[model samples]
Target: MAVLPLRICGDPVLHSPATEVSDFDDDLASLVQDMYETMAAAPGVGLAGPQVGVAKRLFVYDWTDDADVRHRGAAINPTLWIAPVPAGDADPETESEGCLSFPGERFPLRRSPRAILQAVDAAGESFEVRADGWLARIFQHEYDHLDGLLYVDRLTDGHARTAAKVERKRGWGVPGLTWLPGVDHLED
Candidate 1:
């Protein structure tokens, strides 16, 4: 598998909702494998199809929780359910998150503590996962990509303003922007 070029923010694919994955074919499997490789190369916990310029509903994640249990898999045509976020401003120390699409930025954003994810694997076999803590947050964050939302899009007012400035300062709020995982060397 190869590391795909990651689409940056303001790319149409990253901002638009992705289509469902109706064909469970070899090409889809290859894409999933590439996504996993790209995520690993980016050193990110998760990566979505849109981030790689593929408008398909899928995401791959590899994260080890506080309990030391490793969670690794691809969610194809996934559906996610989340509990309501706690009532308070986001805590930067605890709720900060980064995205491969945005690259080298982390900001506090409120997310539900619990989530239930249902999806099929690359082979089209269905499965379910009950998640909490960071795993839950990962699911929610990736799922948002399928719906055309980024973590920055969900940020509070102050953070949103900051994100806008960063986007403008970096010259990233336009289409045709992309980065290679290993070559770009962006760290969060």
Candidate 2:
């Protein structure tokens, strides 16, 4: 498998929502393989198709602590279920985050602690998985990318500003605000 170049925050393709996969064939399998390779090479826990200029609803993630876990392969076309919204006056604490597309930048953002996901493997077999902790957050984050949502969009003013500060400290500039990919221009 070959590592694909990651698209940065400004790319219009990254803003667009991804198209659903109509056929789970050899090409899709190859793409998933490449995604896995690319994610591993980046040394990130997750990577999505849009990050590589592919507008397909696909992503690969490996949240295991051991590098040997890569031998288990990747998750394709995963479905995600986030925890219910917190009740009134409750604080949703922010968790540190990083993105494959935005290399060299890291920030804290709020996210649910748990999630359930289902997806088909490269062979078209379905599997369901439940995730919590960092794995859950990673799943939700990457799944959002498939829908053209970035972690920054979920941030409130204070968090966004804090994240921006961290980004600046790391010598990263403000990301270009643009329409979500695959969405209508009007919505953008």
What TM-score fits each model?
Answer: 0.97, 0.77
Flag regions of model 1 displaced more than 4 Å: none
Q: Which lDDT tens digits does candidate 2 get at residues 77-128? A: 6778889745433244547787766555465666778898888777878888
Off by over 4 Å in 2: 65-73, 85-94, 162-188
- Pairs in clash, predicted candidate 1: none
The per-residue C-alpha lDDT of model 2 at residue 132 equals 68
Give the per-residue lDDT of model 1 (tens digit) for 10-57.
Answer: 999989999999999999999999999999988899999999999999
Best by lDDT: 1
The deviation in Å at residue 16 for candidate 2 is: 1.7
Give the per-residue Cα lDDT of candidate 2 at 131: 76
* Candidate 2 RMSD to the correct structure: 7.6
TM-score of model 2 vs. true structure: 0.77
